[model samples]
Target chain A: MIELLLTPLHYEYMIKAIVVSGVIGGVCGLLSCFVTLKGWSLMGDALSHAIVPGVAVAYLVGLPFALGAFASGLLAAVVMGVVKSKTRIREDAVIGIVFTTFFAAGVLMISLFPSNISLKTIVLGNILGIADSDIIQMLAISAVALLVLVLKWKDLLLFAFDPNQAQSIGLNTTRLNLMLLILLAATAVAALQAVGAVLVIAMLVTPGATAYQLTDRFGRMMLLACGMGIVTSMLGAYISYFLNGSTGGCIVCLQTLVFLMAFFFAPKYGIVAARRKARRTTDALLISGDAHPVPALRGL
Target chain B: MSHGSTKLNKNDISSEIDLHVNEVTVAYNNGHVALFDTTFDLGAGTICALVGVNGSGKSTLFKTIMGFLTPTRGSVTIGGKPVQVAQKQNMVAYIPQAEDVDWAFPVSVMDVVLMGRYGYMNFLRIPRATDLEIAIESLRRVNMLDYKERQIGELSGGQKKRVFLARALAQRGRIVLLDEPFSGVDVQTEAAIIELLRELRADEHLILVSTHDLGLVPSFCDQVVIINRTVLAAGPTHDTFTQENLARAFGGTLRDLRIDHTDAPDGTSNEFRVLSDDEEPLIFGHDGRLVDHWHPGIDEEESK
Candidate 1:
């Protein structure tokens, strides 16, 4: 079993793919906690899809792909904010309109100028084709994002939980909000080389959601999310090697599987455990001669 | 109109203006004026109640004071400084309504209270021992010290309010603004919070609370500010909280509660009769005709 697992490490491209996917996964997981808590899961989906136009534009020009990705992602976020504030439209509707338009524009651009860039590679990722420069970029971006999130988790938590209270406490919530958006754009751009646009949202949201079901504390949730990200990415890379399938697809599927496991088996909050707890409590109540069950325990 | 009459005679504390809202007007993006040129001054060592009907801009006024919203016209000063300056110096703290918070957020009671100390620390600075000590002391003040390690989502409604109060207390601010602090709290917790506010007032803190409970205003609050897009009346509770001002602030919705005077059977005194919308008539003993007894039952029902 050990030799079978170690077989994929012999290939240089597989080694590079594993490293890039692991880094991207860790950063996405760290940020997912904030995104899910703030109800910005759709924002992640929107921003990821919105980056395709930027990537196409960068290919047209001589600039790097990540720059185009970041610029377009940031533009999408700013436009969403403006539309929500300036007009009476709801946020989800604005997000849908903006992301779809940008995504359609990107597809049009790709079709109009089809030379070296393939839509297949951009939609699904080209993890095996990742170069040393792409690896450096991913590592650098992930390192900066992780460091900032780790050091300033409390401020972000306060802002996400209650923005008004954060502002009242002298925290410049506008700057904090903008900072989070910028980091989100940067992380999305970094993950683009590994999972591409289509599956990046899963990486950006699943780990945090999975960890949330298992822990009641934010710190533990973050740690557990990061652990899940690395473990799942590594295991998914190995599994994909054996299955001869898409690495991003395998990784996202494994993340979904892990989330499902947490949903049904988490000790404190899982469905099965909660039902068992209810039965135990009812049994205790009956033994104590209190025939009436507690009202709070009825729903469980 | 009768301003500063309810000012307490506390000599030990400095008689500085803690909150001053001067000719402030706040308007929404849709061009609706929420608060129109309202002004008020609160001195140290006083408990002021901000009372208004629905959509009367009580929350708009509080948000402007907290620097969450900017006034279109005028300024708000705290401790003779700008609102932003005071907020940065940790001279102002706010306890928002319990429902405004995300209860399912993954935070302990201690973590929530420790957020109060963030204003004192620099960027990226962790809470130190002194901050933890202050947080624990604040939780103790609100009688939530035992639940400090529990997740906030596990708390009851009253406990949640107490936790927010403890967060406000941990700020150690000279001026505390509580928005509907009694909304979902039980009677026991309400009494405990009132007692705690009294203690804070005695310690020379300026406590400005917005509440729908007008009955508690005359007895619990030292001053009252009645607002309806503007300041209709603001002064000592006994002097400013009259029938005409309340009727004007509450509009025709308040006129449904009719109070009349009838001669007692003994023929020596007049008994006041309160006829509510759907409830039975209640009688109160009085010697003469009470011109206008404003029962807040209708207001409570309207809020619900």
Candidate 2:
């Protein structure tokens, strides 16, 4: 297996596929921490799917896909923001309505376009046969997006956790909120080219959510999420390489599998770990004839 | 952390009071008045309780003070200046209602409170040791020192309030506005928080709280401002808490809440009425009408 892995380095396309997918997955994994932490997983999904119309429009106008995706994602964010503030409806409802309508509009536009352009490839992703330019675009866009996110991490965290306190403390919460939405849009757009709309939600949510189950600390969760994304992306790619299966689907499947494992087996808060600890304590109490209660933790 | 210091020159301290609302009227987008023609002077080193019954515009008053709402008729002044000053952004610290937060956000209590120091920290800089120290000190003030690393989502209602208070404390502002800080708090936690507020007062911080707990007025407040779409009363508690004043401000609806009198330390009765029965019959004005064959004076005899 090691020899085969090393031998694949000679094939530039294979190397490109691995290196590009790893970079996208790793960065998105870090971004996922913010998404899951903010409880905006659904919003991320909405933004990711919402990129379709932009891509379609770009195709119609013969523009770069990233430009279209970014524009449409930004538009969706604006719509979501307006609906959230101006109306009494919950944010999820607004996002749902916006994404669904735009997605339908995208599908319609794609059907109306010339048949030879192959819009279905965009839905299923172009990971296996990814071209040099596609790889370059993914790397360039994802790199810039990730850099911006890291630089503004504190501001975004503040706005996400408490906008009122953020405002009162002299932070420009309005600007930060808009910046966060733009970052989300950019991340979605960058990831869109590799995993496509159907599977980007998992890439955005599962790794971060699984990391959340394992730790309560923000920094640790982000690190764990990035690690999870990298691992899942590489393994899924390798598996797809051997089996000729869908790389994006395989990646999402691996992410789902990791989430399930963390959901049940995470030592800190997982269901299985908690239950096992409870049982152990119950047995100890039965044997000792008294309960040694755990002291409550302090210092948030 | 040092914004709380006396290093601020008298002029600097005086100059920072720039939150002003002039003839501001705040109505819902639908045009229902939330605050109307409200005006008040808020200075440093005082805790003003914006007290009233539900929908008496206590929150509206706070919102107006924070510039969240534009008062329709009168304007509020901070430091004898308008609210548009550039230096005024970090001058005020506001603690909103507990329910306003989305508790499920994945962040440590420390992370939430440390955000208060964002005003002082450079925009692109990561939180420094100073920020951490300030955040921890703020948490310590609120007795949340132990939960610094705990996720905010795991906190109880009172704990959540304390966390937010810690956040405001970290802001190190001279004026702190807390909305319903004692709501859902146990007696012990409430006492702790009241002690913390008193300490803040000693630092010459101005604390404004919107609260329904009229019982706490005489003890916790240096001054009480009763608001009901407008200023009902504003003065020291003894003068402002009179039954006639309460009746006027609360619209006579809360009169049935029995007031119990207890003696003072000097053997003269303290004269302040404690809550006797939360639910009791209202004493009616003289109508000269008989009820169940008993007159107003005769009812005392008939019951015996």
Candidate 3:
């Protein structure tokens, strides 16, 4: 088993794919905590899908895809905000309408202007065939995004927990929302390079959700999510070397497995554990209402 | 933690604190006036109850005071500063309703309390030793230090409210706004909260507690501001919180009854009147004085 794992590390391309995937995965995971906390899972999906047109436009114009993708992602967010505000449409409906329209426009552009960029690579991702420039762009974006998130985590956490209180304390909540939106767009663009659009949402949501099931602290959530992201990404790449499968598919499958495991078997928050706890508490011997319904966690 | 020197005295904090709402008027975008010519002046060291019927602009008044809404006609000043200025200076704290909080958030009780010190922190908002001490002390004040490390989601409803009150205490703001703190809490929790408010008043914190619980209004609050789209009356609780003003504020919504006791043993001929507006009834004794404690009359009769 050791020799089999070592065999893939000998190849430069495999090393490249694994390294890039791990770092980008960690960034996506870090961002996933905030995204999930703010209930912006659908927004992640919307932003990632909406970037397709911008990516295609960048490819056609011979410019960096990040710029075009970031712009269009921002536009999608803004359009959703505007539509939700301007009309009486609910936020989820606005998100659905905006993303589908942008995605369709991207498809039309791809069909009209076919080139070296394959629709499959853009949509489903071709992590194994990524280029050198793409690696630098992804790393730079991920590093900066990571720095910002780590530095401002407390404010972000407070804002996510209670916007009214956050606002009352002189925190610029509007600016904070704008900053999170920008970060969301940037992360979506970076993640698009690895898992493509459809799978990026999972990369942006699953790790944090899984972490949420396992821990009761935001700091722990952040660490567990990032660790889950890195391990799964690299392990998925390694497994793909042996199975000769789609790396994105393998990574998503692995993440799904972890989430299901947490969902059903995590000690405190797992469904099975919860049911067991319910069974045990049938008569609730202590009878103190303040006894903490779940097992007591003293906290960190 | 060197709370040694930086800690501010209650006198220093409260002496300069004053909240003045001038002839403020708020109107919605569709040309509906929610509040008109609402004016009230409140100083420190008093607990004020903002009493009003639903849709009588209580929420609008709160929003205006919190700087969430701007009044069309007048201005609100806090301690000689504008509402926004006071907010930026961290002179205001809010203990919001339960519905506004995300209970499942992955923050510990300590973590939530620590957020109260954000304005005093550095750019990164890292809690220092002093902040930690303050947070722990605030939790202790609320009698919740034992549950400091527990996830907020794990707490009971009353515990959750206490944690929030602890956060407001740690905020160290001159003016604290509590929105419907007793809505869904049990009798024990409500009494605990009322006790905490009394302590806050003793500390000279300007507390504005809004509630539909009329019987609770007089127990702890020292001042009262009754409004019906505007200020119907504003003064000391005994002076301003009269039955006449409350009748004007609530109109026909208040349930009133006068049961004259003619067959008393002493034969002094006193009355037993009760008034309710969907909450704890305000009961009057044979001497026609507002009975000071919460007595669920219907339940007491059941027990009898």
Q: How displaced is residue A284 in candidate 2, in Å?
A: 4.8
TM-score of chain A of 3: 0.92
Flag the better candidate by lDDT, 2 or 3. Answer: 3
**Residue A217, candidate 1: alpha-carbon lDDT:** 92
lDDT of candidate 3 over B1-304, digit per residue (tens): 3432254453254477889999999998878999999899998889999999999898899989999888999999998899888887777899989888889888899999998888778879877888888899999998999999999989888999999999988888889999999987889999999998888888777999888999899899989999889999999999988877887888777766555656668988777655677744667878999988644332222110
Better of 1 and 3 by lDDT: 3
Segments of candidate 1 deviating more than 4 angstroms:
A294-300, B1-17, B255-263, B271-304
Kindly list the per-residue Cα lDDT of model 2 for residues B1-304, writing each as its tens digit: 3532333234345634434445556777677887777666655667788877678777776666666555666766666644433224456788878778877666789888877777767667467777788788889888899988888889887788888889877877667888888878888878887888898888777888888777786888978878787678777878887776776776645533222234335665433333321354345435844344322222221110
Model 3: per-residue Cα lDDT over A200-267, one tens digit each: 99999999999999999999999999999999999988889999988999899999999999999999
Q: How big is the RMSD of model 3? A: 6.2
Indicate whether candidate 2 or candidate 3 has the larger TM-score.
Answer: 3
**TM-score, B chain alone, candidates in order:** 0.83, 0.78, 0.87
Q: Output the better candidate (1/2) by TM-score.
A: 1
Report lDDT (CA) for all predictions: 0.83, 0.74, 0.87
Report the lDDT of model 2 for residue A297: 27
TM-score of chain A of each: 0.94, 0.89, 0.92
Best by lDDT: 3
Instruction: Give the residue spans of candidate 3 off by over 4 A.
Output: A1-4, A282-300, B1-14, B265-267, B279-304
Pick by TM-score: which candidate is best? 1
